[model samples]
Target: MAAAARLAWVDATSGVAGDMLLGALIDAGASLPAIRAAVESVIPAAVALSVDEVSRAGLRAARLRVEPLIESPPHRTWRSIRALIEDAELPEPVRDRALAVFGRLAQAEGRVHGVSADEVHFHEVGAWDSIADVVGVCAALHSLGISRLSASAVALGSGRVRTAHGEIPVPVPAVLELSAGWQVVSGGAGELATPTGLALVTALASECGALPPMSLESTGVGAGTRDTPGRPNVVRVVVGTPVAEGGRDELVLEANVDDLDPRLWPGVLAALLAEGASDAWLVPILMKKGRPAHTLCVLAPVERAAALREAMFRETSTIGVRETAVRKTALERTWVHVPLLGATVPVKVAHRDGEILQATPEFDDVAALARKLGMPVRTVLEAAVAAAVDQHLIPGAELP
Candidate 1:
């Protein structure tokens, strides 16, 4: 059996920064030496990383500092940074995640400055320390084997911060652009969430909410530079195995349409799914004055509700959408390949509490194999089911 997937829930209630997140991951048991090596592989001899036990408010936390070894780090364009990361000798997953974070930053900066992403020159983020922080965070996540990442609503501070461009208001344009779909609030004064930090969360985190249900394993507190008296200037990361029985928080968006053509419903449903709806369907109903209509219902994660709602408006003629919070409980699912009729057919297994509840062959795969073998689709499906049963994939059986 495959190992259970681990979840990392980032508590950024105080605030989040790249360095702070990296520190939290390190304190949570990620190898500092591995992170250092990954960063050095990309930007060799440019910076050094070190961590110290520090106090934030009354709480003890890890503070990671990136010290630049060079006199002056060059302000690099997005193109240059992309080349450096792409050419580096690093693990595939780590390299891919690092590139994603930087890509988000580049796009945000480009949109804010009215320039193309490739031509955008990073200022504060172009420094060696910032690069080290981004790469180190990705490396740490890879080292810790974090399969799923979620975060709480981010705290974007108030007031103004001086930047290479000028003194800008807190939650700068780039940060605001990146935070479009996610929730945010002003947790304190001054700039609490930097652009790099926002990019890390928005680009990498799959969902945003309060702490999720998990079997607690370890907690790491990463301290920022300030040690405020009343509030802890830190980001906390809780790592654990997800609770299978717990239901995930979700939202339902409904829209009633009476005038749309029946042929368009298919396209609208497809568009909603593309916009992040987990499941979307239509229910036929009779409306006022005996008018027939279809009620469109969409299921979506909380973080994706906004975009999916907008998609509904754009794709359909509905002027308003109603939303309701919901809880979704799902069985653990996995896929296995079964040999049938000289072809491999994939079977989806759904299980609960270590017992398989159902095993279904992928119809599309069965049909494709049938076409290739010049056999009936029904025959191919039966063979596939027989193959799965032969492999002990059935109800009440132990999950493979």
Candidate 2:
């Protein structure tokens, strides 16, 4: 089985172009020789694939330049594009990947032009060079062993773009239609997004929102050609392992109880956390009878539903607590060994978009210390985290 891989799109806060993205990916560690071979394998021998190091927005990036294969347009129909991918002597997997990206593009174009998928023609992306870029990306990813892809909101520019159909409104109907449900933002008032880019992203990217928190292993910076102010003219592709194990929708147990002792809240929460609940908390509330109450909420993973209910009954004096399964997207997480305060303790790591966003020392680690030193577990955990941060042993944010 292939390793689980994820691709996250960086905001490009400034802008992104084809060459820039290719460059950025190369910079992030996509093998240049492999990328070149992938492109060569798909295109006619006449087309030259040129990749050179170039600086954009004061950052060095690999610039991918594709020499045009034909002086005139292919005017390639969807069928022809599909056939080219099918007929190409590329590997079966590569051909299948190419067809998938093209198929998605065709569907988006069909939607934009109010035609059936079979009737839409890819005027811009059907160009020979475009084919190389799209196919090369797929091939590079396959070579990198990546199977999953995602992006931050895509930096799709706003303004007019001159195409075969003359000047059309910015974002081009096809790109806009394809990027549905994905976060897309305007940048530098240029044509930052291409139909091929949108289609590739929409088809390959598994998630289209913010970079999910992740422990970043490496990053690839793909450089675009345009020089825009205030934003890096490159796309940052992040690759890393997802930390999440399997999780399911949870029941949120909530109840407002005015008569319970406030001191019981802490123990209740701890018990819930110990009983497999994902998270537990309390909020101050004013009941209808004008009595002050604490609204306790418990978010329990599916398997712990009964345990959470039993705890509520045992800990709180409420006759009933509302319960319902609520779906949530959470980062895959794991624990790592980090030395802090003269000891190596396990630290919890959370990731999204392939970057480590949060790292906290395990409470059990602190509790162990507390037992050894006769101190509170919270104090030990906090001090250990602080020491880890002060010594630059742990990442940002102390234990919470």
Candidate 3:
């Protein structure tokens, strides 16, 4: 079996930039020398990366600066940048992640400027410093062995800022386009989140919300240029191994409804699941005045709670929804294929610490196989279970 993947949760409440994230990763013990080497492999002698301790609202953090060495760094197109990264001698994971980030940027810029992604010229992001920042962050993540990444709702500014296309709103068009489906807020008065930073998060982060439950490991804080008065203008990264046996953090959203058509409940539950809810169901309940009602419950990640809550309001007749924080302990699961009626059926194996707790055939797969073989569903399920047993996939059996 493979080792468990490590997790990195980024706190971008104060906002995020490529440089800031890079600094945070470095402060979290990612090797800066390794990151610099990876950056140099892509753009040799084009820029310099340096880090120093800085105070952001009295909080000490690492500040990474990327200084351009060339007098005039040519604006690069997405095609050129792709080729540059592809041609560089970097680790496969780093190259793939860097490409993914730049791909998001190119697509966002193309959509905003009404041009094809390949033809879109990244004016500010194509500069040596931005390139170094992107490459450096990717390299840092690779160095730290971070297999999973998540972030919080990004902080955006309210005021306008000068860009390659003159003055635009705080969240420039590119940033807005990249921020689709993710949460944001008017964090401050200036551009708190940059296009590059947003691209990095949207492209890489698997989830967004509060800091996830993790086995405490290490924490790093990366500072921005300004030291805001009340808030720490810094990005924080918490790294740790996921708890193998402990419960994971989750949110429970419930609403009681008595007026909606009972037939619509299925569709409502489906919509909630489509909106990122982990699970959505209904429990029969008695409401005020003894009205027969169904209590709709939704299980969701903290990052998805907002969208799921909105989905509930839009899909159900409930006037209000209640949310509660919960923890869920689940078994580590894997699948094994068993031959049934000349076709393979999947069996779910649940285990902990390499000890098998249960092995159950997938009912849907069994049903499909039964239909295909002109056999009874019960017959197919029995055969699948027997096959699993024959293969030593039963409870109390050791997980090889």
lDDT of 2 by residue, 91-126 (tens): 544565567567767767877778866678778777
Native-vs-model 3 lDDT?
0.85
lDDT tens readout by residue for model 3, 1-400: 1122567999998899988999999999999899999999999999888999999988999999888887999999989998899899998778877886887788789878999778999999999888998989888888888876889999977789998899988788888988887889988888899999998887677667888777867899998888888889999999987765356667788888899999998899888888778798889999888999998999976545544654675677664566666777889999999877778999999999998999999999899889888889998888899999998998899996
Of 1 and 3, the candidate ahead on TM-score is 1
Model 1 lDDT per residue over 46-157, tens place: 9989999999889999999898888989999988998898899988767767776787788789889999778999988988888998899988887888766789999999
Which scores higher on lDDT, 1 or 3? Answer: 1
Worst 10 residues of 2 by lDDT: 391-400
**Model 3, C-alpha of 242: deviation from truth (Å):** 0.9
Sorted on lDDT, best first, the list reads: 1, 3, 2
- Minimum summed lDDT over a 10-residue window in model 1 is located at 302-311
- Poorest lDDT segment (10 consecutive residues) of candidate 3: 301-310
Each candidate's root-mean-square deviation in Å? Answer: 7.9, 17.1, 9.6
**Candidate 2 backbone clash number:** 31
